[model samples]
Target: MSRVLVVEDESAIAELISINLRHAGYEVTIAATSDQAQFEVDRVLPDLVVLDWMLPGQSGLALAKRWRSTARTRELPVIMLTARAEEADKIAGLDAGADDYLVKPFSTNELLARIRAVLRRKAPEALDALVDVGGLKLDPATRRVTRDDREVRIGPTEFRLLHFFMTHPERVHSRAQLLDRVWGDHVFIEERTVDVHVKRLREALEPVNCARMIETVRGAGYRLTQQVQALSN
Candidate 1:
């Protein structure tokens, strides 16, 4: 089940959101202050955060900005829930790294829909089905990557990158897209980070002679070709 953190200073609002989310089959946690919210995130990162714009101490905008600036929480998905419906306020919330924004007096159904949409976009690889392409196999459940039954040693980031490529084989994915999909959010992460992780993924696949499977498309991005034999040479 996807975990959701609801950060609202008002007890009634927080309880309402929490109850609705729980009823919808989501694991819900509520925080009545920015400090408590930060603590919850530090202890365990939730799949998504429903943050209130105004808080007791720090505003939701400030918290979102802080999370975006930190490497560990940079890719965290956030949806701003606030009474500030002005265009400028909405722009500021988005610029602060909110994936989606909802004003007060919002419908529960609409909020749920937005949460589902953001989670779908942010956690496309939430499924654990095995993916195989170009003789490379990745088992999300086991968290393993292999070629010809030989294990491929890789870091966490590289593993995720390879999983995405293998799942969408032969499709060229731009650096920005990769960052958004693999990193969960692209607003805070640099595009160059994709290059770094791609290099590492290739290095991990080198011993198995599958490094060339990931092709760098000129003037484009990268593609994991299904024609494994052709690239083996």
Candidate 2:
């Protein structure tokens, strides 16, 4: 299942799209502001973005351009959704690296079609592979985590949760975002379930002396980071 992050300010519009996307078997998340959208993207890279043209703080155009400039999100497929049908606006959006463009008052059928087309155009990567971060190693092939020549026992869910964190180390992930990514998008699990699993993951790593790396960002979310080491300028 593909994950989509819809960045729309209007609650009605966001809900409408989310409902439709979910019905179509696409895992969907709705972000109502530029800040929220950016935070969501920072948490996990969605398969595709349905971005609104006008936003409250930073314009959608600016957000798209910024994502293009950032290495992590550079190739992120985006479909600009806006009421601005002017040629200039479309061209600007295209220049901003939008994979596709859809004018508002658009039909849900067309929107779904466009999303499918964009996804087909985007290249896919191997999700199962060896990951190593800060001396902690996880091998998807072996389904094992090892540190300092010692094996770490972890549950299936914890293994996957830890895999996501290790792969995206040093970035904050909100419970909602983690649930969408780690637990399948359409999963109806509670947000607190994420906290419980995170705690379990930490306890599993405690034996390896790597538990302190997962830091809780009060009022925000959690992040996996390397041990603090001062760098010389």
Candidate 3:
């Protein structure tokens, strides 16, 4: 059974979510504050976290940022719940590294679906096994990437972006497609944000001279090429 952490300040809402998740055959843990949530996360790493935007002490956005900075919970999927329905609020949540966002008064079915999707993406699967493109190797199990015989250190987002490109090599993918495939469909982020991460990914690959592997298609999108190009003399 997948383990989930529910971080909400309201005792009633927390209990409601916990009971519903438990009924859905998931192991659930509830924390009423950011400090408690962090402690629970350290004690037992959850497959997914349902975080409330408003908390007593530290806000959920701050907690999410903390998780992104911590190596152990960096890649852990998080779903942010907030009463704020503005586009700015959604963008802020996504920018803070939330895997998904849910506004208040959300349906139980929708919440359950979001939880399942996030957990499915995070769950260890065969697709996450080692993948090799040309001489480059990406091992999701070890969260390591290597070119030839050398190891490469990449940021969490960059790693996911590279994995997506490698798995779908030779095909042009639009920014929207990349966002859906990598950031999850439930995540609301600017399409331009994809450009930012692509730049970061290229920077990570620069030391290995593999930066050119990601090709920009002008107005279209991006493509991953394994064929080496000749240097202009």
Candidate 4:
């Protein structure tokens, strides 16, 4: 059974989450404070965390930041719950390392849907351990990249960046979107950092002659194209 930790300072809110999670056949643990939540996380690493944005003593954002900094919990899935529904607040939550965000007054059905989506995305799947698009082939299991069967070595961060692009091919992604999708929403890295990773990814692809696969759209952001565009002579 999947285990979930619901970290909310409000008792009623916590009960609501616990009840729904139990109804969904999940083992639920409740933590009313950030410190207790951390302790629970240490004692029993949950499959996912449903964290409130606001909490006494330490806020949910702080807890999410802490989790991202710790090696053990860095990859843990988190869905942030917040009463703040403004765009800025959502961005802030995402920037703090949340995998997803739930605004206040959100329906139980939507909350459950978000939880399932996050878990599904994180779950291991039986896929082609290696996916080839254009000349680039990426192995999800080994995290190895190859071009035309020639092995290419890339840093962990760059590998993740490339993997995300390959899996989500043809879609133009803003730096913020890429950051949230590839680096987890709770990461506090600057949006400009995405540019740095893209540069490194391009450099790695240069030797393989696949560097043109990553396209930058002026005024927009970046995308990975399967069809290699021919340059005019």
Candidate 5:
């Protein structure tokens, strides 16, 4: 069963959501405060988080930002729930890395639907399967990237980005597609951020000389091709 964490200060609403989620075949946990929510996440990372905007202490926006910056929780799928009902608030949540947003007074059916949609979108690339490309091997089981027995020191996000590229190599992926598939479908991060990470990923692969495998398709996006271009000494 998929695990879901619901963070909301309202007891009645929390219970209602938990009941609905449980009935829909989800294992549910509830946190009444931002601190408690963080504690719950630290204890057990859920498959998805349902976060309410108005928390007692830190607030859901802060919590979302914290989660996004943490390597362990960077890719945790989140659907933000809010009473603000403003487009700007929704944008803020997405900018903080929420995978989706729902305004207050939402139907349980809609909530459940959003949860299912986010999970479906994130499931495939979230696997722990190993990926290999262009003589560079990445083992998710070990969380290691190596070539010719030499290890590549990679940050978690870069590792994920590289894994996505390797899994779908030889094809150009537009920045929007990369963000959806690699960074979660609903982030409001700029496309330029993708360029930065791609540059960093190349830098990380430099020692192995595997950097050239990632090609910048001008006016398009990027492609991880099996064909390698010559590298400068």
Candidate 6:
């Protein structure tokens, strides 16, 4: 399920959007202020953000610009939501890096449609395209992984896990996050399952000298990093 962050100060409007989004099978998180929104984003990157123009601390426009300038959130999809209907205001919102803009008193149906469109636009195409990170290569079309002309034999679960990690390289992903993203959320697998698969994935990559690419982030979960070097024992 895609996760969406709704940053709206109005209690009724936020709750209404949250309800509709949840009904549509999206994981929804509510933030009443820009600070809270930033806090949530810092905790875990959401698939998309529904941002309000005006907030108690800082305007959503500023927040959008900040996110756009940041490397981690540069490609984060955002739909600006506000009472402003002026053409200039809309342009400013887009300039601040909003993917789409929605004026208040908006139709919930339209909002949902726009959300779907934006997600479709921003999501990485995993089935057809080939993903390359550092020297590691994953071809979804062939379901193959190779490094330095050597093939890395991995299981189905490990293949999916590596694909996700390669696509979102350098970012920490908790076991729960990995499960939700890699394995379907409908699956009731234990978090320990991730550890087991990760170990197997590393073992498969070991033959290709790529096992060091996957790093455990201490208290965090796992990260696929491009800085692959043999660690000292």
lDDT string for model 6 (1-233, tens) is 67899999999999999999999999899999999999998776788899999999899999999999986677789999989999999999999999999999999899999999998876656446788877789999899998877888899999999999977777688999998989977577999999999999999988877888899999989998766544511
Query: Candidate 4: worst 10 consecutive residues by lDDT?
Result: 224-233
- By TM-score, the best candidate is 6
After superposition, the stretches of candidate 1 with alpha carbons farther than 4 Å from their true spots are 125-233
| Regions of candidate 6 where Cα sits further than 4 Å from its true position | 124-157, 166-195, 204-233
**Candidate 3 residues 1-233, lDDT tens each?**
56789999999888999999999999889999999999998765677899999999999999999999975577778999999999999999999999999999888789999998887776555267777766678998899998867888799999999998876555578898898988997576999999999999988887777888888989989987675523300
lDDT of 6: 0.89
Tens digit of per-residue lDDT, candidate 4, span 1-233 = 56799999989988998999899888899999999999998765777899999999999999999999975577789999999999999999999999999988788889889989998887654144466666578998887898767888799999888987875555577898888877997577998999999999999988888788898978778988755634310
Q: Give the TM-score of candidate 1.
A: 0.57
Report the poorest 10 consecutive residues by lDDT, candidate 3.
Answer: 224-233
State the C-alpha lDDT per candidate.
0.87, 0.86, 0.85, 0.84, 0.87, 0.89
- Judge candidate 1 at residue 17 and give its lDDT: 89
- TM-score per prediction, in order, is 0.57, 0.58, 0.56, 0.55, 0.58, 0.72
The predicted structure with the larger TM-score, 3 or 6, is: 6
Error of 3 at 129 (Å): 5.0
Q: How many backbone clashes does candidate 1 have?
A: 0
> Model 3 clash pairs?
none
TM-score-best of 4 and 5: 5
Question: Candidate 1's residue-wise lDDT over 1-233, tens digit each?
Answer: 57799999989888988899999999898998999999998766677899999999999999999999985577688999999989999999999999999999898899999999998886655456777765778999999998889999999999889887865556678898788788985588888888989999999989988998998998889988756645584
* Higher-lDDT candidate of 1 and 5: 5
* lDDT of residue 212 for candidate 3: 87
Show where candidate 5 strays beyond 4 Å: 128-233
